[model samples]
Target: MAFVYDLCVVGAGMTGAAAAREASIIDNYKVCLVGPAEPKVRKVNTGKEVFGAHYDEARIASSTSSKVPVWGILAERSIRRYSELEHLSGVHFYDSVGSLTVGTRNSEYLNKVEKQANSQGYAHSMDILDSQQLRRKYPFFNFSSEDQGIAEENTAGIINPRKMVMAQISVASKNGCDVIRETVTGIVRQPDGNSRVVTENGRLIMTRKVLLATNVFTEIHNLLGDIRPLYVPMPQTVTLAEISPQDATRLRNMPSLKYRGYGEPSWPSDYLRNNNDQIDFYMLPPVRYPDGKYYIKLGHSDDILKGPLQVSEMQKWYCGEGDKALEEQMFRLLQRLLPGVTFLSHHGDACITMVTPNSQPYVDLVTPTVGVVMGDNGWAAKSSDEIGRIAARMIVQSDWSYDLPKHMFKLYTNVTGPPPASKL
Candidate 1:
């Protein structure tokens, strides 16, 4: 008879890697993480390729999330462990340049951010800047007269998603966890009350329990048998502006920016004009990519593609360059935001994010032997470690042991009607 492992985590992205590490360290349990490595070159002709959003170089990391207060809590917990994980794995990925959130003065959004920051005792690490102060401090940025900023100087900055995932996997490998580099095709139940994870390479992994962190590909593979989670795969595009070395150095002190306001009359496109909640955008500081070039990345919160993508349509979308018109619009917006800045070149790429009905992650069990921790909703990269820890504890202890209400992470499946408007 073949040996049965204690737990098998399918999906080696940020959340899955963190869960594998937590499960291995919680006690003496045989754990394995299964997922394919990033492709050397992105090609859509190959029908066997799988892509993840964590293939990027920079993602904003801050304790203040505009979506909900619970997300902020998750970010704080994970940010507190970045240093420890770095030391343990010997991988440096976090940049502590701080983060900035800008919005209208005394607006509901900024008020909620201020309340959460104060309640979390972050007053000492935070600085509130009025419109004049923002202009005086960051002259390169242009903002309206009603805009105010909250600068988080500590535990808020940018993280390289690739390096972060590598760090977690390194720690887990040293803790006696097995790492399998393959794509999981499906998960099936066994006759002995266990689960079998099927891989694309014809390998079967038997375990007492399985956790699916496959993100956007979760529903496409039908891993949960007959039950399907109600999620929409929303397409997202990001534009990168390549600057010269001198320009990069000049903007070395720039912080990650999250802007919430309607800029100039010509800033928004027609799609943005129809929606009241579509004027939000985020920008990352200049980061060096694999090609050894520094580029500043920017993306909008609203979906410019205009429709929820079906699973079959995802591969073709990723194969092609993102919406060229939207990319041009973003480039123009960047130029206006930083007037007189020279951009050597610009390009865009396509990606997908899973949006749930309520805009929160579903970290619940699908059955007695199969569990799931997915539905990123566009905010999981910053808080993945804590989310993984909670999931690991739930599986290891056979119960939901986290302080957060279990219902907050409950699973929603087989719903009718159209999906709700995204709050990302």
Candidate 2:
């Protein structure tokens, strides 16, 4: 039977949508997106609601906590792609300014920032400030630390992520592709290279190529194996709280930044981003609310709204009520750090983080018809676009531009060093 489309995408979230859009617009291939018919009633994940929380138990068992992520190197690549997106798709990227990485002098914790910056030659306005110098420059930083900070005044800032995703899809649809919403129920590989995607509604889509950009949802398709760094699927609360003009000014002077060393020697870290309307705080977990129910991005309750992160084996801890514990701890952490900042959320939701054993994502051809695109962490932001581009390149050539070691696909785990072809 003839395939109905050249390429079919599963899932309609940011990654899937972007991939579908790219194949159509960049590759000019006919495409269709399969998922829900409409924005169906989304159930919540109680585990994700755990506002700003972390777990000793979870971290103790984590495989990649004590070291700088090997995958962190991929960020420079994404930045390059973002620089090109405006010209490639007519999408303008607004620079959010640079990032401030805080820590004490002689501290190994803050070294990750230095290492990355030196290797990438990223142009940023930066400074190494003493405790007094740091305190005087930014009034909001009340914490005292013996360590110095490496401020990258250059290339760190925010890119309207939602806008980026939407623009890509818009470009794709305009380029002669169809986007569908249907829950894929089955798959049929025909005698030819084409495949048919069956939906819950008994509808089927046939295509010569299929791309799976369904982040943590890949668990549902039995498509992932025991990869490491072990991504945890938890709810992330991004509260866009309104800041007073005076308060906004104070925050603005501080700029967008990240803190690499504060807590554990090898435990997870936290970061912050200051924007026009609000600032965003990001961490692994220990989130909480005054009422005991976990809230993501500041909402009224404990219900976990189902999004991309799932509750399967690789992502099971967040499927149930894990958020309750995370939220409580997260609040305590925030209270210590932000002292007096009111806790109110405007856009909290759970997200899936693909952490591999070695800090790399699973971007390999699992089968001739299917390729997996899971980010351990780097792909969480800009790398996603590059990932889609990589997939399109693979499908079009039936060959990879970058060569992989013979064992890269054979290894059940991810590695950071000693592998040349493994570079992404």
Candidate 3:
């Protein structure tokens, strides 16, 4: 007789791992986490290979958001637990170097961020810096005269997404949750109120309930049967500029940056045009990659593929190098942002963001026994822990027990022309 799991999570990425761990800890349920490991070698046109956005070394983690106050709330909830998770799993993934947000003084975006910060009581932890103060504090950056900054000097910094996932999975395994390293190909809804998950290697597992954290691949494999959640899988390009160890040490105090609005007027007009006249860019300080080199990473959140990429295009996009022209623009922007910073070499990588209608994550159950926790909208890396917790409680207790309203995460099914405008 096959052992039926109390709950089975269908993605082993950050959210899925956190969900599995939380579910096991909540009630000691028989939990199973399923997903393929990162590809050892990223070769184009490979067979059945899947990728996740958490394969990087550094992601900005902060309790300030320009979109909604709820995001800051979620980030604060997760940031408070980084130490506990690290200690329990014996993994170090977070760095408290701080995070900085800059935009024109009293700009609409900065105002929204300040409002959210105040609502979340994060204003006290942050230092508001005028353009002159910013220049004095961080002499390395080249800020426009009108730019004002809000610096979160504590409780905000960077997280190693890969290591964070590992930490969650490590603790989950210690709690007796089974970890399966295989790609989930399909899910069969049994006649009874249960599910049978089928993997690519011809393995089957039965579970009382299912949670899908599959992100962009949620609909690609038809895991939800005929239910198609409205989402746009847009392609993103991230460029990394390798710097010397001396440069890395000299700039070790650099904080992760979120710069709003078009930068220096000298920047290429085509790049600005491609980004829809918006030049908002987020950057991570020098972080060592797997290749044993330190690189400064930067990417414009709005500079993405024009139309929503189809499921067939994802694999190819992931395999091939990202847009070369965009990469050049990012590298040039990085050079301008940090003058006199020389680079050994630079290259581009590809990733995808799943944007939903409301720019919020969907943490609701599609069916009584099937739940979904996806649609990151570029904010999942920082808030994944709390998001996962909400989903786990929903699955384990079989109720909407979270403080936030359930309708905020309500799932939208079928029919959509283009995703609604995003707040981020």
Highest-TM-score candidate: 3
Clashes of 3: 0
Taking all chains together, each candidate's TM-score versus the true structure is: 0.94, 0.69, 0.95
Angstrom error of the Cα, residue 50, model 3: value is 1.9
Clashes of each: 0, 54, 0
RMSD of each candidate? 2.5, 9.1, 2.2
List, residue by residue over 36-131, the lDDT tens digit for candidate 2: 532222234422221111111111001011143333434445555665665667776435344455654666545655665555455244577777
Task: Tell how far residue 20 is off in model 2, in angstroms.
Answer: 3.0
**Which wins on TM-score, candidate 2 or candidate 3?**
3
Question: Candidate 2 has what TM-score?
Answer: 0.69
Highest lDDT model number: 3
Question: lDDT values of the candidates?
Answer: 0.84, 0.48, 0.87
The best-first sequence of candidates by lDDT reads 3, 1, 2
Give the Cα error of residue 56 in candidate 1, in Å.
0.2
> Which candidate do you rate higher for lDDT, 1 or 3?
3
Clashing pairs in 1: none
Candidate 2: RMSD over Cα atoms? 9.1
Question: By TM-score, highest first, what's the ranking?
Answer: 3, 1, 2
